[model samples]
Target: MAHIVVLSGAGISAESGLPTFRDVGGLWKQYSVHDLASPGGWERNPQLVLEFYNTRRQQAREAQPNAAHTALAALESQHRVTIITQNIDDLHERAGSSNVVHLHGEIMKARSSVDESYLVEMNDQDIALGDLCPQGKQMRPHVVWFGEMVPMLESAADIVATADVLLVVGTSLQVYPAAGLVDCARPNCPITVIDPGEDVKVKGATIIRKTACAGVPEWIASLKL
Candidate 1:
């Protein structure tokens, strides 16, 4: 089966009623990135950090997958579909996409502050200040903070390199590392980018200027796969 590697971002999740960082009334408008999304912020105010993520996690839990997510998941029936997402939500998994790589880590999980490998599923629970890990250290959201290294970067790049077809969805291609994954694709591989936003400048890419909900299903329909 052909390998279809999908690089998704906040745009797709927005279709499911989740807001993107830059969107109107987004979290960015309410909070400073440094004050809530960086290690330095956590150091200064752990309670504030915990509350912020707890609210976000609840929002994620309330959201349902949209057409775009379902369309991508359906692709697994005909191809080896792999999803690399910058989103911390599990809408892709909820929509039934089996292979997903979350470069930004998952919001529905928590890990020890001292032990990155010691993670636990958090479902819809809030991660309060006193939440402790097995080693007696406070647990923090499993998300990759702004300045932290993205552990899944190399894996995502390797997947991109092997893609028979590359689909870039919902992202503006402005974020680093994740933004660069598209460039890792084999030169000859077919590349498709679907977004409702303004024109994106990806050389040789077949850009579909429509929201993921509208564009993804249309693209799959054309594929006849």
Candidate 2:
């Protein structure tokens, strides 16, 4: 079976009503990135950081997988589908895609604030200010903050390198390490990008200009396998 790797981002989940990190400007008023997403924010006020992610977790739990997610899941029946996503949500797993590598950690999990290895599944529950892991250390959301290293980038790159077909969806290829995974794919592998935004500068990829929910299914339908 052909190996199909999908690189997805917030735009794909945005279709399910989840807010994008960068597009939260007009709706609830704008907040500085250091006040919400950065480690400095967590250090300045752990409670606020917890609250922000709590709301996001609730929103993620309430959100349903859209056509784009389902379309990607459908590909498993015909190919070896490996999803390497920048999203922290479980929407892809919920949609029944077997292989998913979360590059930025997952929202539905918590880990010891001191020991990165002490991770635990959160099961839709919010990580409060006092929640403790088994080691008695306070548990923090298992999200990759602005300055933290992306542990899964190497694995994601390996997956990309072996892909027989690569699909880039919803991302503008703006972020660092994760965005650079596309470059790891074999030069001859077929690359398709599905997005409604203006063309990105990724070399050796066919751009399909459309939204994920509308474009993914149509693109998959046209594929031979």
Candidate 3:
């Protein structure tokens, strides 16, 4: 069976009612990126950080998996599929994908401020200010913020190296390390990028000028399986 590796980003989640940061009038417009997702921001106002994520967590919960997410999940039945996503939401899992590598961390979980190993799952709940981990440190969203190293970068690269077919979805190829993962694929591996943005580009990739929701189902239909 073909081992298909998928790299997804915020664009994929946008269709699920979870608006991307660039989307106008979205929640992101009210907060600065540094304030909502940065170590310095957490240090300056942990309460604000907690509140922002709590709202986002709730939004993620309300969002449903889009058609693109479902198509990827069904592909797993015919091939070995591994999804490496920059999105922190659980829509992919909700769509029935069994194997997913969340590069940005999961929104449905929290961790100790000082201990990355100490994790707690919080479903449809909020992480209050006083919420403390076993390590006695305040609980923070289990997400990789700005200025923090991506914990899954190495593992994602390793997985990408083994892909017989590499699929890129919704990402602008602007983020580092994650964007560079395309380089790790085997020289001749089939690489396809699904995005409508004219600026989105990956050398040697088959670019599909369509949204993930529209392009993914079409791609799945073309599969020999």
Candidate 4:
């Protein structure tokens, strides 16, 4: 079977009703990127940090995977599909995709603030200010915040390098490390990028200029894998 590697981002989840950070700008949700997404913000106010992620977790719980997620999951029946996602949500897993690597960590998980290795799965319940890990240390969201190292980048790159087919969806490819995974693909590998926006520029990738929901199924059909 062919190995299909999918690199997905927030844009794919947006079709499922989850809001992206870039779209949250304006007075109603006035938090700046640095204020809620960085370690400095967590240090400045852990409670606010907890609250921000709590809301996101709740939102994630309510959203369901869309057509793109389902189509990707379905590919596993015909090919070896591995998903590398910039998203923290479990949509891919929920949609029944067997293999998924989360580059940004997951929202439904927590780790010891003192011991990064003491990671734990969080139930659907929201994380509060006083939440403590098994080691009695303060628990923080497992997400890889700004300035934090993405430990899975190496693994993702390896997956990309071996892909028989590469599919990119809903990402602008502006973020580093994760964005650079496309470069790891073998020069002769076929790449298809799905996005409705016109600003994406990925060298050597064939653009499928359509939204995730509208484009993925059509593109998958064309693959005939």
Overall lDDT per candidate, in order of appearance? 0.91, 0.89, 0.91, 0.90
| Order of candidate numbers by TM-score, starting with the best | 3, 1, 4, 2
Pairs of residues at least 3 apart in sequence or in different chains that clash in candidate 2: none
TM-score of every candidate: 0.96, 0.95, 0.96, 0.96
Q: Give the worst 10-residue stretch by lDDT in candidate 4.
A: 21-30
- Indicate the residue-level lDDT of 104 in model 3: 92
Superposition TM-score, candidate 2 onto the true structure: 0.95
Q: Candidate 3 at residue 130, lDDT?
A: 91
Candidate 4 deviant stretches above 4 angstroms:
25-28
Candidate 3 lDDT over residue span 105-202, tens digit each: 99999999999999998986899999998867899999999889999999999999999999999899898878999999999998999999999878
lDDT of 1 at 80: 94
* lDDT (Cα, tens digit) per residue for candidate 4, span 1-225: 999999999999999999886674444277766778898988988887788888888889999999999999998998999999999999999999999999999998888888888887877787777888887878999999999999999999999999999999999999997989999999999899999899888888899999999999999999966
Q: Give the TM-score of candidate 4.
A: 0.96
Q: Which segments of model 2 are wrong by more than 4 Å? A: 25-30
- lDDT for model 4, please: 0.90
